[model samples]
Target chain A: MRYMEDTLLHHLHTNDTEALKTFLFTIEELPLLQVFTSLSANEKAIVFRLLPKDKALALFEALQPTAQHHLLRSFTDEGATEFFNDMAPDVRVRLLDELPASVTKKLLQSLTASERDATNLLLGYERETAGRLMTPEFITLKKEMTVEDALAKVRLQAREKETIYTLYVTDQRKKLHGVLSLKELLIAEGSQLIADIMSHEVIYVATDTDQEEAARLLNEIDVIALPVVDRESLIVGIVTADEGRHILEDEAIEDMF
Target chain B: MRYMEDTLLHHLHTNDTEALKTFLFTIEELPLLQVFTSLSANEKAIVFRLLPKDKALALFEALQPTAQHHLLRSFTDEGATEFFNDMAPDVRVRLLDELPASVTKKLLQSLTASERDATNLLLGYERETAGRLMTPEFITLKKEMTVEDALAKVRLQAREKETIYTLYVTDQRKKLHGVLSLKELLIAEGSQLIADIMSHEVIYVATDTDQEEAARLLNEIDVIALPVVDRESLIVGIVTADEGRHILEDEAIEDMF
Candidate 1:
């Protein structure tokens, strides 16, 4: 840890963004988090700012809400606003819930309309429900689409979606239909319709389901992500196993406190 | 658990092979393992024989060596030979080590030359070392290969490989040079060289490294698989996170006993 801190310090002093990016990105998340926690607020800000945008977003998302809030406090308003706007809606909501009401309001106002709406959509759910923790950023496939077309759509949305490992299939009306993994898609014939290949028995949760229950379902099924649907059975979002683990970790920490 | 057992019994009574496959495959592995454990030896054999070949292999791989041994004893010599031949080399080695010397030798005789050689290769390594716990099946990418070629190779080898989630970049002499995820390969331009996109800093273990330490490194890196190299730095095999977890679990169970 000390070696890492010293290496980072040297990278900082030398202004080596390439080496710094590689150094920071290559380190394991838990160890990196420890290093960040060990640094002063100013040092934390410097390190965070120096990270490439994607790496910064990834590191920021890995942080607990409390750590996120503390780090956000050290950033300039512009930096803070950009980070808030860029965060996945579910993660942004967690951070917003940690901030003072006025600060939350200001941050929410700074978001683009789409992001603000997405954030508000999540906020509408009960605090401990699956809906509140799921990211709305997911690629849904139509059962009629060929595997080739579905793969194209997945690749296009891969940058924005929370996960492409597990894909959900739906009708035009947004009714959940089937689920298939990326590996399945990769192995299937390109001309095959998604409905022909996808498993009809998709294991999923309703929006109102308890977060812990949803996490358990995710773990039980051993899939990358679990779909969350509304009362109408309209697919709304997906909760990743990572998010589920985080929710459990946060719950455990709260219990400890 | 009772409900699951009842469902399995119903499937078996009705002789519903298709329905049984769906039922067994859809259930979580942990719960399914529990159900298997609770069954009588005859019932277990019946249930095991009913599973689709692929699902049977998967379930067999998930069981601890003791459970695997118990299950194997109930299988006919022909069934046992086929199962032994199909299993990943590392897993086969573990189960083989548990059998009495004569039975192990007979089983070894039953294996195809390739699988027999692979098993022998792993057996040569010291117990509780990475070499003894890594599957020899892995896809390696050359640095000069285009992303398109790499993707094609990955798709071609996906089924046989232990994991397609992490791909290793290696030279002609099989020296591991870099590493990249499938996601990275998917997102990169088709014309780009693998060398340009892969991370030069690969996290790996020596073949002789302690199994527990190798598992720790795999966990620390958060990759699906860790490449294992020989003393001469030649890529030998890969140890997956699932295998690492199983090793840890078996160790814990051993400690308890």
Candidate 2:
């Protein structure tokens, strides 16, 4: 990591774009997909032209909606279709929200049935609200699970989760019981029960809460992320700091002009 | 320099106010008086609170007139008196321009006879023009000097000047004839005269030109700085890229809101 950082700094100092591209290509084996997701629209377009089609589409799905439109306009019909098809349901909904109704209709016609339904469900909420940003990509732990068993379950399910920084603890009825940070789990003795370590005074926002308000609360408290819960207080999804920063930057830009 | 930068970075990151004050106290050997003069009003206030009373007053006098007022409000009568005594004539004029008449009169009374005369001369010019921002700190060279001789003279006089990036090449009458970058001097053979290497096509802004327009002109061209000339096309002062960037940031902030 230090060597890669040093190499990137050297290239930046010399303004060597070719060297930078070579370095980026070599580091594609790492979890660079997350870093690629954080780039601005113009920056993504520049990188997209340098990477493989599949990698480009994967990165595109991770981009903010504004960036998706920009990348789509820069590509041919076949390329655009490949990217649109590979995008996640929640991400697709965000893109559709920004597009004209006629364009949205045409794009919706291209999606599979399940993708269309998932996107439709997400699109029902107003933009810049918790419901619109939340993804149904999280793990729910049953209260009956022992500390050892819960840890094993988390390790098995971690790959598919958005973040494991904060684990949402719920009851058998699917109602959120408490929340626990990953730090507490690592330090706790294996014999200790999960319910003993978890804090029942859970801090979370409702599905309809304003996204800016959610972001502000997270920033004020210096938390890694916040969980979004439904009307019945069941965990829906989490809004991580990376996504919150993107939303904040967008808000700052909007306020600037 | 690297050590100082590291120490400053450490204090900034840790928000260690006491360490910052101690670090500034230890740097008394360096000629910070000139550096303080270049900083904006807001920057001065941030740094001044950490310094001793004597050093603070000396630093305040080095600042521009606009900065002086801002700093004055943060000091006592004794501190203000010491600062006013040390302030340059032209800077005093600039300070009085923005201040209310009642306050300006009180400040003027505090200045010595010679300083008051110099202040009056600078105050005669219109605001937001080259006449307002320019310091009378410049050196004019005869167009006939050998490259070696010119370099030696610059080395001797550069300490008091704002910038030695671009030296104005003038005829015997002190009329601006051409301009030359410091790069030309270092690379030129000893035999060449200043006239031979200097570019006759000098781009300069008039004393009355808008400050923002002057900054834009400097940014558009690949020049280290632009020379500000009076109505008769006599070079007065140079506006460097450092100052240009500061002006651009201010404009960007104003446009932001």
Candidate 3:
């Protein structure tokens, strides 16, 4: 306990706005988040002001729409711009979906051209569809690649990808063919082609599939991730295990009440 | 993913028994547990054989009385002894609560003295109360320690305890006083005393409180854990966030169907 406390004190003393921002952005601690939510508006604003711009934006995106509106009203124009611009397109769409049309219009106008297009595409989808939850970040793999080459490709693009754990295999036209895990590549003989080991017995849901269905499929299969495809069977994104677990947890809570 | 397939194959080959045991024990994934009341004798026996001895016992204990009787008749003497010996006292009590006195007497004869005593104690309580779920695994802390010292106590005892995230504070009389999080201790100054950092505004459910009430209290606070106490405010056990989340998810699934 003493060691844990000392380490914590050291981090606290050395912590800057960047570290604090990162912590706030990826805050998985529900109890702390609840406590923060229950704080006075002024207190929340003070905490918000202390966070880095990007962190503030991410944290704002994660907040409930009602809380977002309350916090937005407190922010200056510059803060609001930073918050809206830094948020992911899908999250922004959800926030817009909840706001009055007038407010959403004003908020949409604040986004960059690319962001606006992304937000609009997501907003066009029905609520609770795969399209609404899907992120645009994914790496597509060519089926001809050797296991070593595929691993190299993953390593190069891994930083920007949502998950490198499961890689989707595609053909010349980028139509989904199979899925592979990084673990298989590292242990297999490097000479072995990805085509030899790729799981052709692939399971996926269409982009228009209901999120609940996607969650159920993931749970039933016990896979870490599931690919999301289009009508043409082209892999677009992956719905991660963590996201599926969160959906399950939320659904469970709803049932209990 | 080729990599995931290889890793899964490797795991499956190396740990077949453990894997089979895990599959059999997870009631959350299996529909058979819910349909036990309708299963034929041969069908029940098939499912029972797939389970490890301990889990078979747990599943047997969890069954409705009529189902238990039908299933028990199918088991050989060795299998019945293994099942009876491994069953938890609280579960055994629930089984006994619904069975006829003659049958209950035969079952009680199979239990060890300690198991029988525990069964009797739990049977005296109302169903679904804190006393039923309380497993006597909680670690209590004296309120006089510094935050650093208190955290050390948690680390030393964490492995044996059910949850280390929320530490229950107690007085000289061993009555519950407050609760503290490891997160709080990490951020607080080392010189700070336990009372200064501890959250005295703790919310708890009494021994007689319903499971739904306990679940609601956990949800309302957004904490991953809650302490259960008796009427005199003595800490009995802690209900973890994961368990609460599971309860909520199960309830949601029930509503969905």
Winning candidate number (TM-score): 1
TM-score of 3: 0.35
For residues A107-135, write the lDDT of model 2, one tens digit per residue.
33344445544443323345578766665
In candidate 1, what are the lDDT values of residues B37-73, reduced to their tens digit? 8877656655665454455656777878787767655
Question: DockQ for each of the predicted structures, in order?
Answer: 0.31, 0.01, 0.01
lDDT leaderboard ranking: 1, 2, 3
lDDT of 2 by residue, B67-127 (tens): 6675544333343333434446564443322322223233344444345344433233355
Question: Interface RMSD, all models, one decimal each?
Answer: 1.1, 27.0, 13.3
What TM-score against the true chain A does chain A of each candidate get?
A: 0.54, 0.54, 0.53
**Which wins on lDDT, candidate 1 or candidate 3?**
1
Q: Can you give the TM-score per candidate against the true fold?
A: 0.54, 0.31, 0.35
Output DockQ, candidate 3.
Answer: 0.01
Clashing pairs in 1: none
Model 1 C-alpha lDDT versus the unseen true structure: 0.69
Candidate 3 lDDT over B107-222, as tens digits, reads 44444445534443322335566544544455667778986587566556655555554677888645788887654554566567888878888888765677667776777676
Which portions of model 3 show Cα errors greater than 4 Å? A1-257, B1-123, B245-257
